[model samples]
Target: MFQDYLFFGVDTKVHYSYRMLHLSHLVEEAKQLHNLNTNRALLLSDALLGSVLLSSILDYEERVNLRFHCNGDFTIGTETSFQAETRGYIECNENSEVVKQLDLGNNIIPEFQVRSMRSQRKKPNLFEGLTSTKANSLEKALNEHLAASYQMNTVLKISSWIDSVSGKLNAFGVIYQELPDIPEEVSIKLKKHIDSLPSMKELFLLDNDADVLSKKLIPDITKAVKSINPKFVCSCSQERVENVIVTLPLSELSDILNKAEDLEMKCHYCNKNYIVSMQTITQIYASRNQVNSTNSNEMN
Candidate 1:
């Protein structure tokens, strides 16, 4: 189950700085993730997953992360920004070797199931991690992370789901923060409302939109307070890749030249390739000292 996608869209540089996105309507079909085709249903789920994360970071301007780890397959994990509109990936291998990088969209998932296993399996990057199994859902897993790690004194949850017949997707998530010396009645009422809300998927599936969901759960006192528009953005580029290669030690460059007549590198996130032929390599090495001398002269 999912409801309308909602977030506070803030662009302080603009005239109308912000507005609330219903995420009320999504394209009938799913968007492509790399070369893979994502189902509309799955896209909605992914969007909701991104939305909840965006809200947490955007509205309060806090540094937070939602990650996935388990004994199950598809250990794709992502962490969002505390500063910019970005996210990063944590990639893993069969032997459970994990590596972190800015390439996140490449982390593929096979199936949607966050189920509990018996006998308590133990291993690295496990036991303390969280994830959602139902229809690839992710909100509850995030809530648990906030509660367990930050020991946050707040109410937050992301409820998302879609209908089986219509195939449309919707999502809504709420986060509440407290100020020191906050009112006792406010805290008590907020807690009750949070407890009374329906399952996140249910909230998204049946509700009108994010606003409706919020009103239904916290009928009286809750305020629009803030909203944000979550976007699917990545940080990868051709120039950055070039800078990396150019800065590598000459020995590493020599190795590549010795092994192959041409040197080629592909960006992991963008899949764009850069190729340097043996001729270029030879010329570059020959002129290396001269080029450095000229650059030094220019600097002085």
Candidate 2:
């Protein structure tokens, strides 16, 4: 099986930077975890690739989130940590006429509201940007976000292909950012180089090492500065599920406890189910009241 990796490199002269990604295995894992149909898989794959591309700008321990609101009924979200751990999901109103009529295979939507959020591990502040595009292209929207938010010159390309025989998805992308103070001629040459290359699908099909591919894209990439393996990692856990249950209103907790059946919670990102037994719910309910009473007594 082919592993997924992201390679970071810079021009020999330090005039530009590059990030190359090979995410087919990671995307396949997501497709299986979410049990997505072809169209849903394609959209999620694109979102995943786009999110990783944006991660190039994140500092260590920081995270970036990408959300796509399609029309009014469909939405997709992807999150990637600076370490390249990624998770994403697709959501839609299954009964909505608009969602039912959407031909996602064509990769065309009437409109998309793209929002990006960046934050550090323990930071209280978040940096967010929102952009709207009618092009029905996630690539274009992401490029717009980078330009407007970071004021950097970047070109991003994401491509995905489905294997006809194995029904597997192969997806990858490249991010090229021209460093500040780059001469106009150098910038023009870089653009021409990117344009003249083969399609992303073709490049990915070669199955070349990420470093080798980076060198192909930017011949001046003397050495790789960073290499990361991105994988599908979900943050959901039983304790988190219990915390969610504890936050419910007394009535809701009572209703669930009265049922005498385990409450099942499913993670949106990985579709993993966590079962909260009635006994556990009752314990949490009691603990919630105990904590509240302790606070009340302290105030008194």
Candidate 3:
């Protein structure tokens, strides 16, 4: 059983906080949900891991938002709530020429968007940038986005891979940030050391130990912040789908009813199917008419 969570340690002496993520299980779940092939799955797994790492720095009650508009076959998006629940989907044209580019390891220059939603009532603070994706290396692109768009001093390393025999997917990642008080010399040293460290693929396959990895990367840590396990969870439900179906144009609803066919709605996030019976549509139509009549009578 693969455990998934984000772990953080803060060194007041160095004025820096270190974070690590072990998310093999979560990545597997997400790939299965999206039905992605190896390359596509690797790309999306990297994005999801980055989203989770980014969300960790959010203030209380804030959520992480990420979007990608690429000149490729598909547009991908992911969101993580303040509570660590994540959902995402990919939209694509079946016969898009960009699909060939994606398969051939060509650069698909993607416009990346990142943001933090403070609350439901307030507008989200947003950041955007563009990067040329080189196969499976999203960390480099995301790091550039952070530096160019947000001007934050942070370093991230990611690794996502699939088993050749079983086709099982896994991911591991790390992020280190320099607080305002940290001296430039210390930051530089840490960054150089982290950059020189072995890739996540090598480290994960050699020894999947978080504590050992932390000590090897950053030898100083005065405190450990809270740790959390994030999961891929969709927010769709049968009731929500039903409410949406009832709001369709009356003519459309009547046509479905006349055909005596049950309407099926598949959620993009989880691919769960919801069926709406004609009887339910009829009841909803009647209820809508009654409310409209009542409002008109009150106006008179």
Candidate 4:
């Protein structure tokens, strides 16, 4: 069973979270949309898991977005809500030489960006960290980001099993963070205790269960404070897309109106294509003009 949750040590000195995803289906859906090969698909899976762990600590209305800009074959990104609904994608030129020799670790420096996803606010806040891919692992890069950017003493573990032949994926992972004001020696002892546990890959192979693994790792954890079920969810829809189309500058809309029978817009997150008919385009134009006219009159 797919499971996601947050738990804390009995004394609340440390916080932990985990996610187990039967990612084959979601990865297949992504592969079909983005034409992902094994390596690119694998990168996307890692980003998703990272996003899930990062977002788990956020407030209900807040969301976290993770973006990586690298010299690898692909620059991967993910956005996840506190509820654990996540979407991710990879950006790259398939024909470039870089793609031919794509290695996630080849990049000298990569930026990890975290941002607020709220739109109604005047300005959203952004926090970012920079790290080198010298170690050639996203996990290490992210741990560095946490330390450097947020000053958080966090250990992030991400793991996945993918079929080489089919490119199918199964992923699971966890994050542990030492809470502030804890004694340094206690922190060291606790971290060492955690380090002694099996790696995520080893744990998955042995039990395939997050709950069982969590208890083994932190026996005195508080009862599940919250339970979350995360999935691949997209926020694109016809009406939402239509609203965006209507906001485009009139000149751009006119170019589309004159040359194209229908406008095709593809979502960057899910790769869903939406085709807006010419009639809807004209209607949107009319509606925009009406709003502008009303505003002009009000100003007069």
Candidate 5:
């Protein structure tokens, strides 16, 4: 059976601490909470390093955020899952040549995803580990992500196969968390135990199943894996983007009008952009003025 709490070496070094999470339990909660498929779930573990990111957002909660930026064949973005599972995706100017010019230096094929963060804000964003090359290793880049965006120190060692060749879905992962309250001595023992563990890919494929593998790795980790959660959710619509344009200052709305007769916006997480005509802009500006005027009078 998989054991979560264990010892690596003799101690005086034996100290008391609580850190780490059950990968299976994490996935089960996700399944019960979302309309997802078990077959499509992945643990996304940095198995080499022993860590994972865990997040859950309700239909209308403003707590979830994701950003994507990569200089590769694919696009980049950030998104949120809102109430009733409604979601929103955002990204930088993807149409430009900035992607093609990336320089990956002596690293694995570049992959970037700021999958988790300590908090979400509406301020200007800072790009982390954006390689100067066409590609870099996905895991190393993520190390930068953990440090820069998440503001949480992490070590990620991910190992999973990528096979676009077969056109079949096949990927599994695991995430190990280190609780902040863990004392330094206990931390040392845990790290040593983690080091002695087998490779994640081998551990990930134990007995031909991810859940089974999770058990094999930490049978007593107090983990619960009922079913896997559904990912690949997209919730973008024209009305939402319209609401965004309406919030812009009248001058900003007029500026879009000056540049062109219409404005186009897209969801970065998914490859969907929208077109706003001059008439649409005019009405948005008009509504914005009304709201502003009412606020002004109320203030007086």
Candidate 6:
């Protein structure tokens, strides 16, 4: 059981930043929770790893969201907090055309519209970027978004390998960004080194932790500045579901009350079901009327 972690470090002299992520466990958990096939599981895994990598650019208490709007109304998304907590979801029915196409071994990556958003806690403002790639690669789209939107020169690599015998997934990613203060010569050398690194398949075959991988990425990095454990955590709860129901129109609440049966809701991320009984619906309806009446009196 390999523990998942994100390792952060900086070049001792050039000040360039590096982030290495080992998140196969998180991806495995997501695959099990969603019951995804290999194609869907790989897409979600990449999105999850990419989101956590993108979170390294944010400040404390900030969060980043990565989304892919695929053809056939299918979508995959992931959100990662600075604390390294992450969740991801894929939206498409098993019998949908998109899943059918995937089953047929079609490559739908080129039709994806990728969106990245960053925001801080309690802040209403968001910094967002959208980009499309004809390359049929998620990493390329992500790099294009960062370059076009944030004006950052970054190299990102994401890789995954599944054990044939055990059916276990092994995924990792590394990002390198040159700081503004880094000398142009040093930046050029860093790019050359990055280009000369081993192929993703070769890298994945090596048994390495974040520390070892970070050093491999930037040999000058003496120590990691930060390390975070990334986990698959969905922020859904029964209370949150109730709150969502309370926001619905009174007519909708009344309709649920009329049925006299529980309204069942399933969380898309975790597939957990929550039952909202008629009693709860009636209470919500009454509460809405009470609030409306009080507002009318105050207005008068």
Give each model a TM-score: 0.55, 0.84, 0.76, 0.75, 0.54, 0.88
Candidate 6, residues 128-147, lDDT tens digits: the string is 88887665667777777777
In Å, residue 226's CA in model 6 sits off its true spot by 2.2
lDDT of 1 by residue, 63-162 (tens): 3344455434334333334332333232335342221111232333433423211112132322233434432335544454445434336445554445
lDDT of 2 by residue, 23-107 (tens): 9999988988888887778778989999998887565538898899977679998999888999999998897665665544554
User: lDDT of each model, Cα atoms only?
Assistant: 0.44, 0.83, 0.73, 0.66, 0.42, 0.80
Model 5 per-residue lDDT tens digits across residues 122-144: 53443233223232554555556
Query: Best candidate, lDDT-wise?
Result: 2
Quote the positional error of residue 120 for candidate 1 in Å.
38
Which of candidates 2 and 4 is the stronger one according to TM-score? 2
**Total residue pair clashes for candidate 1:** 21
Q: How do the candidates rank by TM-score, highest first?
A: 6, 2, 3, 4, 1, 5
Worst 10 residues of 6 by lDDT: 204-213
Candidate 1's TM-score reads 0.55
Off by over 4 Å in 6: 93-98, 207-211, 219-222, 290-300
lDDT of 3 by residue, 73-183 (tens): 576777777656787776766677665666565645444443333343155545344544443346776787666555558878888888667778888888877787778
Better of 1 and 2 by TM-score: 2
**Prediction RMSDs, each to the true structure:** 11.1, 3.1, 4.4, 4.5, 9.4, 2.6
Candidate with better TM-score, 1 vs 5:
1
Off by over 4 Å in 3: 12-14, 104-137, 148-152, 164-166, 242-263, 276-300
Tens digits of per-residue lDDT for model 4, 200-271: 667767876656776766634545555556777888899988989978998888888898699888888988
RMSD of 5: 9.4
**Candidate no. 3 TM-score:** 0.76
* Model 3 residue 211 distance off true place after TM-score fit, in angstroms: 1.2
